[model samples]
Target: WKQSHDKDNTNRIKNSTENTSTICVSVCVFLQTILVGDSGVGKTSLLVQFDQGKFIPGSFSATVGIGFTNKVVTLDEVKVKLQIWDTAGQERFRSVTHAYYRDAHALLLLYDITNKSSFDNIRAWLTEIHEYTQSDVVIMLLGNKADMSSERAIRREEGERLAREYSVPFMETSAMTGVNVELAFTAVARELQQRSVQQPSEPRFQIHEYIDAQKEKSSCCRVF
Candidate 1:
């Protein structure tokens, strides 16, 4: 009788674990992720490659204000929809870009590997992020255009050192060759998902408010 009772308890525990897993898989989460960088740093191209899986060669008429795209990523059996905004890199649009920072859950800060000035300006961008976004915002530093090895101005070690100084994750990506583009976004999404699960009661920005505000400004671009 004792052995039979033990087996019954084990079966019940297994069933309970399965039920918990099922609940976790059913969870759907939305995360507001944004990309910020200097103009000509390939921020838009990175977003395009991640969303559409293709690279647009040559120059893209720099995003004037802000444009966004949505992609669903699954992390730990949870569905996370990433609302990724591509902010204008030009100085004139800094204010416009800053306004969206408060509600962002994660940010990808990019700098051109071939441009030393762009890398140098990372401090300014980090300052703005601290000023505008919440303290817990997840940020990743990316050195883009890794494919241009011969023209590389920023060494990989330098990127790693800067990231360590700021205490943020760092990676080198090539939007032209689609290297680590997907991984970069996925890494951000995974972190966001984990944070949401851990802080279930955290106050969240209403999606409706974002939609209403976007309607007022027709400059927002939606890629799909």
Candidate 2:
């Protein structure tokens, strides 16, 4: 009788495990993050580091229009897929690249800390995001090349000021040393997850409109 009872309990446990897996899969959510910045700011390099875990020096080739890769990550016991798009930063590619920005769940705006001009162009990039993406889209400003502090051209205070002005989170990272790169992405994922939980009734299709409306409200407040 004991042997028969043990077999029954084992089968019940197996079934329970399967049911749990099914429930988790049904609730799993995915997000897409687009990385944008002026050319030569290490956008592609940073992505390659995160996605592939390999770095190729002197492998700098201009991204033609848009390139993408996907990664699966687990955050707070939830499995999430991240589809990352690396876009070309050239002026001529703007028209082609606009579509990639539309449906992005988050944006990582990167600039070289060693180059003052790249740091100064943050406003232009923000304008592009506003034009192409919903105003509620999460934006993270990243100062790259943190490994080259000896050659730093842009002060940390300046980057922080702009990030505050735009109401976005900011961080300094080094694709070479791999500093704060992962943390920046994790912060974005957490923000997206929190938003999803708070507004469970909001349909995914209406997210863009919702964000745009928020942006309009913020802009109106600034005017007054």
Candidate 3:
């Protein structure tokens, strides 16, 4: 009778362990979304507002290479952990910034609504995406600072046209007023969730290993 009791107790402990593992896995769906754009387009500000619900003004310095933040959000009854990366916009930092782009589940391509040059540079960003990601990567074009319509240089139609040309989603948003910021991220989360449903076995994350492998290969070739 003692042996039988011991066996039953062990089974209960095993079952409890399995249940705990399942709960941990179910509570968070890891998703990586990257924000990329020209300097001064408020990429950092938008992320700060979304993550903290507070707005900070003034001449903030550009990101050096890449900065990351994590937040948990619920979509369609599933809890998801969003890992957001804000990359530097300077040309000299492109090499370092490109390392953050690989395997990203979604990319937010931001542009200042009041800066025509920033809008024009969207093509360059698209080229970068094409170089590192698959066609399946979710790309969203965001016209930020939409509150400054008086200073707006890129019209809504122009932004929409580019988005259509690239076959990506587009939206106008005001980070300062908290307009459409949540919606933009929600749309990205929804897209990722849909993709996850379609591809159940594959997880969504940045391809850090792939970048590391490429760097190693380049260094080896240089030595040869």
Reference-based lDDT, residue 222, model 1: 22
Question: What TM-score should be assigned to candidate 2?
Answer: 0.76
> Number of clashes in model 3?
0
Quote the positional error of residue 51 for candidate 1 in Å.
0.4
Error of 3 at 10 (Å): 41
| Alpha carbon lDDT at 88, candidate 3 | 84
**Model 1 TM-score relative to the real fold:** 0.76
TM-score of each candidate structure, all chains considered together: 0.76, 0.76, 0.76
Candidate 2 accuracy as lDDT = 0.77
Error of 2 at 196 (Å): 1.2
Cα displacement (angstroms), candidate 1, residue 196, comes to 1.7
| Residue 175, model 3, lDDT | 78
Per-residue CA lDDT of model 3 for 1-224, tens digit only, reads 55664466467546644654565476556677889999899999999989988788884798866677777788779887777888889997787667657758889999999999999999988998889876677888999998898998999899989987987778788778777687678677776775667565766543333323433554322210
- Over the full model, what C-alpha lDDT does candidate 3 score relative to the true structure? 0.77
List the global CA lDDT of all models. 0.81, 0.77, 0.77
**Candidate 2 lDDT, 1-224, residue by residue in tens:** 55664466467546644654554474476787999999899999899878766666888898866776767677778776677888888898887678767888999999999998898888999998999997778899999988888999998888889988987878787777666676667667767876777665765433334333434554322210
Candidate 3: which pairs clash?
none
Where model 3 places Cα greater than 4 Å from the true spot, the runs are: 1-26, 199-224
